[model samples]
Structure formats: structure tokens, C-alpha cells
Target: MESGDLLLYKRAMFRLAHISDVHLGPLPAVTYRELASKRVVGYVNWQRHRRHFLHDGVIDAIVGDLKGACPDHLAVTGDLVNLALDGEIELARQWLETLGDPRDVSVVPGNHDAYVPGAFDKICRAWGPWMAGDGQADPVGRYTFPYMRVRGRVALIGISTARATAPFMANGFFGNGQARRLAALLDDAAGKGLCRVVMIHHPPVKGAVAQHKRLVGIGRFQQVVARHGAELVLHGHSHLPSLYWIGTAQKPVPVVGVAAAGQGMGGRNPPAQYNLFGIEGEAGQWRVHLERFGLVGAAVLPARIAELELAPHSAQVSLSPH
Candidate 1:
């Protein structure tokens, strides 16, 4: 083994902080010009001057707990913004900057990041400073996903589920290039005896938005994953956590989803929650201890788990399909 490998192994208790769907900054009241339509925006307009669900307090608590947990690495699944607004991107940037390092943090863009026309190709570049430089591009921005960073043999594979879809579609998609590249990435990483963790903006399993089932063409992606196998898979578009086993001929990868750290409607679920995974063992022989950290009244409560085991975003734009 390498030098620092022992430290990670000896500790065998490093924290993996997972958070998604920030949806920062509310929408400003606009003039309809007709003078008839009033009362802010839509009937369920979540982005108003006032806080609807996700608020600053929620983020503050989450950030504090994240620091206290002392995670070795951080992964953000996506939906960093609410309406794909320009300001929202910067807002998300500030929130994420609180983390220790950019190299240790990995992210994938959700549907909202690309909701407006050419949002990904346009706005995401500006998010560079926050992430320490254009956030690791993939050849002419063809696929903006970042490669896995190895921390004591732990590999993080990030995928882009950000696509510009049709109106009334709150769905996500992954193209051909991304799928093929992802398959190869998994194979290579697995061969290296590295713990492979796949991160995306949408859930590869199902649920979240029903009816139209905008999960169009995830079958191939699933097939590739099953072919090579993964240790863990993570996402955050649904604003809820659903666990599943996506196994290949080689091994099984536990896929999980989490809610928005800033979203909590009348204390709907866990007010602005985030997940922490404590893993132990080697590449293919790893184990997970999943627990949650969230806001409790005014004090950030910690739902800590000691050497445990087990497993376990947003809206906008009518893209892909609803």
C-alpha cells in the first residue's frame, strides 16, 4: 500500500458528506405589463422575496454540521439553483465555497443548472472561481463531468445529467458519449481496486417525478453500470432519498438520493438535510455507515452513527418531460 493509505485505513472512519438541491436565491417580482395579473408570480411560486422552504438558516446549520463531521471528501449531486437564474449560480457557489478544498469536492449539474437556454455552456464557466477553475472540463465541454479523485484508493465518478429539455418537463437525461465514457471509467477504476462512487444529478432507479417518466434512456446507462459494477451511486434531483441495488456481473452498487439542504416546507421531511457515509475496507470489500445531519430548531443536531452499516433536488423548466 501507499503512504497515506494506512492513515485512511487506520482511521477507517472517514466521513463522506453528500448534499444536493440547494436552489438558492428567490425570484424577484416582475412587472406583467398587463396590470391584471399580480400577487408575485405563479400560484405556487416558490421563489419569492420571502423564504418558501429552503432558507439561509437551513444552510447555516448544514454547513456547521459538515465542518463538525470533518468529512474527508464532499459530493454534491446537483440542482444547485432554483430557476436557473444567473444570481442563483453565484449564490450556490458561495454556499459550496465554505467547504475546505475544491479538489476534494466533486459535483454534477442537475436539470435546473441547465434550465435556461444554453445555461450549462454559458453560465457554468463563471462558477470556475468557486471551484478553483472551470471545474475540470472534458474535451471542449462535450461532457462536463469530472474524473474520479483518488483519496487513499477511493474513486469518485461524477456524471452530468444536465440537459435542456422541452417546456413542462422536470426530467433529466444522459447522452451517448457520457454513457460510453462512464462505462469505461467504471471498468478502469474497478480494475485498480479502487472504491468507485458514482455521482449524478438524477436518480438512475426511478420515482421522484411520475406520469411522463422523464427517465428516458437510462436503461443503457444502467446496463453499463451493471456490466462493470460500482460500490456506491448518489444523486439528488427528487428532493427525497430512495435506495436501490444496481449490480453488475462483477458486484453491486448501492444508489442513494438526498433532499435539498435548503428546502423544508412546514418541516415537510428533514428540514434541509444532508447525508454522511462512513466507509471501511478495501476497494471491492468496503462497507457503508449512512447517517443524516440536519437542522433542529435553532441548534444543528447531529445524528451520528459510530462505525455503523447500511445505506441509503429540485424543480424548474419543463425539460425532457414532466
Candidate 2:
């Protein structure tokens, strides 16, 4: 390897990167034909209204950052592709394969991943090889999306919040079913003194869910979190990074989202970004340093960094909350 490559590898050893909402491909290629609803019209309108791209800019930008960060493990909250198009899923895999070891990268599904019929099944079957590691055991073992990992000082509790609700809904769901098992999974993780990271596609509370009751069921979900007292909660689907103070919980566990990749291909900038988490300090005093990275150009550059402080109940908290 070149001297520069060796230096990069050396630097990458200390960070854990968080990037979500890549939306990897364009409308036609990224989506199987839209369901018979307003969503179809929305997609058509988006293409006409936004920037067009041959390769989704966000994916390239994220891959570029991955090479630079060389993280221990990359955690993606969800929405890897715009739609569940076979090509889109394939596109996501191709990008992941190119960016970093598919092994080092972990993912949760967002609403978009389940937009089409049977999208999750096919993507999981095709991509399962890269998602597993030695001694990895499924928590629910029921679905590909809801799983767990004991990464570093934090124990990651990933859950499936993706669901196909109705035409009017662009929001997310965790289903009452997963809610039943979430507490158990979290209890076990916390009992071991692991700093819990609850990953989901939908915000347990925030955004459109605030205005529309039918948008999603964030209340019940937060109930599970309150009971378990998760250290951190990483989320996407809003296309904007956010931090909401969970009032009932013990402390403010950060709920973060990343801008969608390939932003302007549709006039939407997606804020095109990602973040890094640096875990350090002693046992009772563990800390998280949230660092921000933005995509500068189409060539996969992530520059412009910032940091946030994480309390014990903190996860990968991003600076400059939108």
C-alpha cells in the first residue's frame, strides 16, 4: 500500500461513522413502479422539479467520506435507496461494496425500502452475506432489519421502523409487533452495562409526526424507549438531522438524521452530509464526540467538520441541529 493509504488506515482506527438517507438511485431505476397512489405523482413531480443525476451524488459523497474516516464500523439508520427498486437495492449494494467492507457497514431500513411489494425480502436475501459477522446472533431473528451488535462501548439495538402504511403517508412505522420485543432486547443489553443505541428509521417523536397523528405512532415507541432508557437513538426519514428532548425519558437521548444522498438531482440539496462518533473516557464517564462532515462536490468529498457533546445517554449527536 502507498504511504498515504497507510496513514489513512491508521487514522481510521479511532472513529465510528454514521450516515443515513442515501436514497441511492433515481426515481425510475430506484423504484419499482410506484403503487397506485399519490406517491406516483409525487415521484413524477420530483423528477421534473429537481436536479438530475447519473449517479446519486449522496452515495458517492458518503463513500468518499467512508474512505477518509476509515471507521471501525459504519452505522446507517435507514433509507439507503429512494425506492425499493431491484436496481435501487442493487445500486445500494454496489455502492457499499465499493465504499467499505460491507462487513464493517451496518444498516436499518427506512420507509422507502418497503415502498414496493416484497422489497425487503429480495434486498435482504441478496445482501445478507455482507450484513453478518462472526458470532453475530439475531435478537428477534425474525427480520433482516431488526438486529443487534455490541460495538465498542455501545451496544447497538437496531429495529425495523419501516412499513407501508397508505398513499397519504410518507412517514414511518415500527409496528406494534416489534414494540413487544424491543423492551426485552434493550433490557438484556442494558443489564450488561452496555450503552444502548436504539436504531430506527422513524423519529420516535418529531417532524411531520408532530402535525399529523396518522403520520406515525411515535408515542408507543417512545414508551418502550422510556422504559428501557436507551443511551442513544439514531434515526432518519426526515431528511434533516434533528435532536429532540424526550421529556419522559431519563435524559435527552439524541435522535439524529442525515441528509439524503444525491440531493439536488431533484432541486433538493439533502444538506448532503454525514457524521462521526469518537468514544473515549472512563467507565462511569464515557463520552461521545459528534463530528459533522458535508459533501463538497460530486467527487465524494466530505469536509466541514463540527462536534457535539454526548451525555451518558448520548449517541452520535450531530452539531448544528436543523
Candidate 3:
């Protein structure tokens, strides 16, 4: 191949980093009024348990390692705050700035982001730049789901599953409207020969989370993927490393999940981790290599724990122990 052809081929390759559930901590001081509603339950949870495991240092270490890897784009799958406090939301915004430019990072909201009746609006207002669609001016007041951002050969479709639930509940809703819009987006991205990477907070697969924390309308999500055929699906909220195959057996789409970005090693949940995806090739012949990096044992530094490759148009996954 000519030098230019080689350069073009290299350009076709994209590196995407995925992280979620930061639950950014040291929960800000709350007033009686602030903790009057669902925030009270979340605050108690954080004080009693969550604050111990979700560490800011772990989040920083993972982000530092991720930056060193130099991904083309980063996808944050939500729960950046503990109680959706005003201070927490602002803190998350500042953290995002350090992560990367809004143009280079895409984000979707998790259940914690909308912990109360009005928290979702505040989250959108604070993180609108990272969540906005391509060519869209800041969607500060009016945020919409299934936003599409095309970078190189990849089209990132961000879906918001964030919604306020009652006390002790952590469910997400994927309504029919979003499903229809997502199907359309997938079809359009496919037509344009772009790799469609759908990012959601709650895993769309069945039995991924507890019944109370599960994604409502998961079947509808499956139907959309079955009909429109996405290239890949990425999610968080399970706070564990997982892999599931959706779509037809002949043309399976990989649905991947990562551990919480702030969970310390040896916690009840898996330790802090993130996923690096190397995407190359073209439509129908797309190649994907996934590497999971995180803390292991008592080590402060992150290390690659798993590596896998997804065969194009098939459900075959070759995983190599790290």
C-alpha cells in the first residue's frame, strides 16, 4: 500500500475508553432540607457503606492510566456523583474537564444521576456539553436521549436511563420513544458505514442487575438491536466486569460492562476498572479488541486483567488471561 493509503488505514482505527459509576465521593455536607427526599436515603447509604469503597484516589488512578493509553475518545456511563447534590454535580463537571475536552468525551446518565424528581435536569444542565449531540449547541435546558456523535468511523449513540426511583430502588427506564429513536439512529449509522456504539447506563440484557435495579423496557431495547443491528453496545451500573452477546447468532453485537470507576480493590464489588476498545476495519468486517485495565491485589497502579477480541458478524470471543 502507498504511504497515504497506510495512513488512511491507520486513521480508520479508533481507540475508545469506557468507564462508569464513579460515584465521586466525600459526599458534600447536606442540610436537613437537602436530605428531605430520596437524597436522605442515598446520603445514609454513602455514609454507612458506599463512601468506604468508592474512592476518589481510585478514580484518579484509573483516569491517569486511561489518559496514558491515549484513547481517541472516552465514554463515561454515569453515576459520577453520590447523592446528586449540587456540589457533587459541579465537582463531576470539573473532573470531566480534567478528563478531556467535551468534544472528545461522551457521557450517559445513570440512576444515581437522577436520584430525585429534579436531579436529572440539574445533571443535564451541568454536564450538557459532554452529553450534547454532534453539531448541537449546548442542550442545557432541553436534553434529548439517543443523541448521536460521529467520530471517525464510530457513531456513538448515548441513551439516558437515568430516572428518579423511590427509596432503596435503583432502576432505569428505557422508554419506547427512545427505543424507536435508537433504532433509527442505528439504521442511519449503519447506512453511513460507521460503527454504531450504543452507550447506556443500565445493561439492556436480562438478569444483569437485581430486580429493583434492573432496566425497565429491556425487551424493547433488545427488539431495537435485533431489528436495527448495532455494531457494539456499552453500559455500566452493574459495577462488575461482564460480557453478553445480543442480536442474532449470525451477527451478534457485543454488550460490554466495566467495574465502577471509583470502587477500591477488595471491595464487595469488583475493583475500579475501565475498558479500552480498539476498533478497526469497515462495516461487515469490523474488528474489535477489548482490554480491561484496573487495580489488582494491593497494587496502586492499574494493570490489564483481561483481553478479548470480537469476531466480526459473529458471537465468537477469544479471551486471553492477563
- lDDT of each candidate versus the true structure: 0.65, 0.63, 0.88
lDDT winner, 1 or 2: 1
Q: Of the pair 1 and 2, which is ahead by TM-score?
A: 1
In candidate 2, what residue range of length 10 has the lowest lDDT sum?
206-215
Per-residue CA lDDT of model 2 for 1-322, tens digit only, reads 9999977655533467777777665555433335454457446645765336424655665567666766777778777766566677887777777655665777777777766557767666655544443355652223544566776656776777666555546666666777777877778777777676777777776553445323366787877777766766777666665566563534555666566545543344445767777665433345666677765545356676566776535433335423
RMSD (Å) per prediction: 7.0, 5.1, 2.9
TM-score of 1: 0.80
Ranking by lDDT: 3, 1, 2
Model 1 ranges off by over 4 Å: 1-10, 28-44, 47-50, 128-140, 248-250, 265-269, 296-308, 311-322
Q: Locate the minimum summed-lDDT window of 10 residues in model 3.
A: 313-322
lDDT of the structure predicted as candidate 1? 0.65
* TM-scores of all predicted structures: 0.80, 0.79, 0.93
Residue pairs clashing in model 2 are 50-266, 50-267, 51-265, 51-266, 51-267, 58-261, 58-262
Please name the candidate that would achieve the greatest lDDT relative to the true structure. Answer: 3
Prediction 2 global C-alpha lDDT: 0.63
